[model samples]
Target: MMQNHEEHDHHENGSELSEMQLRVRALETVLAEKGYIDPAAIDVIIEAYETKVGPHNGARVVAKAWSDPVFKQALLANASEAIVALGLMNRVGDHLIAVENTPRQHNMIVCTLCSCYPWEVLGLPPVWYKSAPYRSRAVNDPRGVLADFGVALPADTAIRVWDSTAETRFMVLPMRPAGTEGWSEERLATLVTRDSMVGTGLPKNPKDA
Candidate 1:
């Protein structure tokens, strides 16, 4: 009986090994035939995920805020609650914080320890955003960091840098772009890029890319 039990255990272990081997073989075949994965492929995959399953919902929220004064006030007052009101607080470990950007005060966000982003609202952070240079330097020298991103603020313009924690996430509510006077919400959402929502880039105008 003991020998039979040992044989059963060996069979189970062998089955598991075979399953793993099959998976590895399949992966190897795909890799060799399809060629090694491209680094740029990661960006394309992430962009696809963002379009299919991420912060596009929040883009609608921002567009609504831009068009409606009351919603904008609610969003500015309590971003997490406002987002919940829009039925978009579904992701785990996501805590939303809104930072408003204005002519006088521009807001930028960074996480020094890790990439703690408001993925529900802004999708994945850009590559530069997760870099150590950006995280370490943004808090200490916000103006310079913005300058590096090609955003040169006026000397008098106050820059507010919000450091996100693992438990809390943040997004930038960019000032509504000019000349978008009568655009629909969907049209406005087109201008809201992930970079603009992260404060590293401004919303693209109708003419601008």
Candidate 2:
């Protein structure tokens, strides 16, 4: 009787959310009812992702690499170690590889099998990133995928897609825009967007940002 009541309540409350969100809500409801988890703790975790450990961490890392040649070298050679040097290590991100977006080539990150993301750096994966369409199209139609994101690369530029896995994740080091020579790391960090870091979009133009 209680289970039926819970299921009814779940359906009543879940009409507006996506299927995945509904399922997660239902699971959370069950766990909370059984005393296995606290809903307040879940709220805290979501708050931390929203306000505390977010894209700013990744932006700092990107800015540091942009300003420091040695750090850039280290990042390209061993991303996991480089990020750890900046103290951004976390449980979900055991191994991370950094890819550079150069003039001739671009890089994009995706997890085709699942939504395996670098949460330590990126905080939380965006909703579209976990959607089925993106997962299927990121590898199969990267150019179109990028176009949909409003990133129009030159026809000559080659696109490289990296698949994220449970053991290894990837981050993109976007090319620094021109006309920003001698800029402070703080200023550069502000120009780094989460989408740019994800390789779905480009960094904001200095003038526009």
Maximum-TM-score candidate: 2
- Candidate 2 residue-wise lDDT, 93-186, digit = tens: 6678899999888888886423357767876777678778997788778899999998889888888877765567889999999978999999
Regions of candidate 2 where Cα sits further than 4 Å from its true position: 1-56, 88-92, 112-115
Clashing pairs in 2: none
lDDT of residue 159 for candidate 1? 72
In order, the Cα lDDT scores of the candidates are: 0.71, 0.78
Give lDDT: candidate 1, residue 164: 69
Model 2 poorest 10 in a row by lDDT: 1-10
Error of 1 at 174 (Å): 0.4
What local lDDT does model 2 show for residue 154?
A: 89
